[model samples]
Target: MDTDTIDGQPRVVATDAALAFIDEIRKDYPDILFHQSGGCCDGSSPMCYPADDYIVGDRDVKLGEIGGVPVYISASQFEVWRHTQLIIDVVPGRGGMFSLDNGRERRFLTRSRMFDGGEACAIPLVKRG
Candidate 1:
């Protein structure tokens, strides 16, 4: 999937800095995925993991992809974030304890913006089980 925009409007996006960081991470773990934390120990940060290390379950909703890696959120969290565009970026800090980003010093952060009427209507509907 495209990094940010789908068709035209974006459901999830990443800054250039974040994309660069993702590329760096990819050098080590070619196959990776992201799951937006639901305010557990990570405080809602975007967590990265090797695809083999994490299981994408039915409760996870695929919002979009970034740097060719898929990003997902829990169905319950999706309900709360459905109206906004998720912006994935990097910040100087520690990552989630169990996330791949943990030892990197820099962590993935999730910022967002509410979709306007047109964007909201244009965004694709995600089917969750």
Candidate 2:
């Protein structure tokens, strides 16, 4: 369900269940985005919001798009996560308090895996594009 990648390795991706959840969310909210929380009340979950509602800061890093929505992480968080791909998945739980997925009986989870040498090298330079 991932929408973009770099040389066959995805910078961010979503599971089929996550994609389905996104589709469900799109029914009521069309323009949305995902921001990976760097630990807080949500515990590092991917928080979805109405694009116009959240202010994406200048220092935020857009890893890629998943489910037709842009996925971002703070620059500081990206420093630690840059070497890995973000795998967005849906699980049974409450979502972040302010996230769009809240009250939906499911939440967006951020899972990751470290990239191989080549992928790690290819990722950092193009985070903004």
Candidate 3:
């Protein structure tokens, strides 16, 4: 769907630097997806995985798009973080073990800002699909 479908209030967006990094990685893995890990192994971070390697399930919530890629979070996590807009950025560091960003020395991070009334109104609460 085109971005307009979300009323132009993107729930997830990426910085120019992060998009550049993602574009570079696209050379190796054409199809990629992002999942915000709820903690534990990944410690509540945004993790990138090849489409074929990861599966979106009933317990996941599609927050929105980031650099044309779908971004998801566990249903439980969404319940706690649904009020803020996510800014996906890249930082220098090792990525989570199972994430595609690992070994690149650049990791995906989520920097969020609470939505204003307009944005909050435009953004719907993530429901299970």
> Best lDDT goes to which candidate?
2
Mind giving the per-residue lDDT tens digits that candidate 1 earns over 1-129?
Answer: 232454477688899999999999999999999999997578889999999999998778888888899998887888787778899999998889988888899999999999886767655555654
Off by over 4 Å in 3: 1-7, 121-123, 126-129
- Of the candidates shown, which would achieve the greatest TM-score relative to the real structure? 2
TM-score of each: 0.87, 0.89, 0.86
Tell me the alpha-carbon RMSD of every candidate: 2.8, 3.7, 2.7
Q: List the residue pairs that clash in candidate 2.
A: none
* Global lDDT of model 2: 0.85
| Native RMSD of candidate 3 (Å) | 2.7
Could you tell me the TM-score of candidate 1?
0.87
Q: What ordering of candidates by lDDT runs from best to worst?
A: 2, 1, 3
User: Lowest-lDDT window of 10 residues in candidate 3?
Assistant: 1-10
Q: What ranges in model 1 sit over 4 Å off?
A: 1-7, 122-129
Off by over 4 Å in 2: 1-6, 125-129
* Residue range with the least summed lDDT across 10 consecutive positions in model 1: 1-10
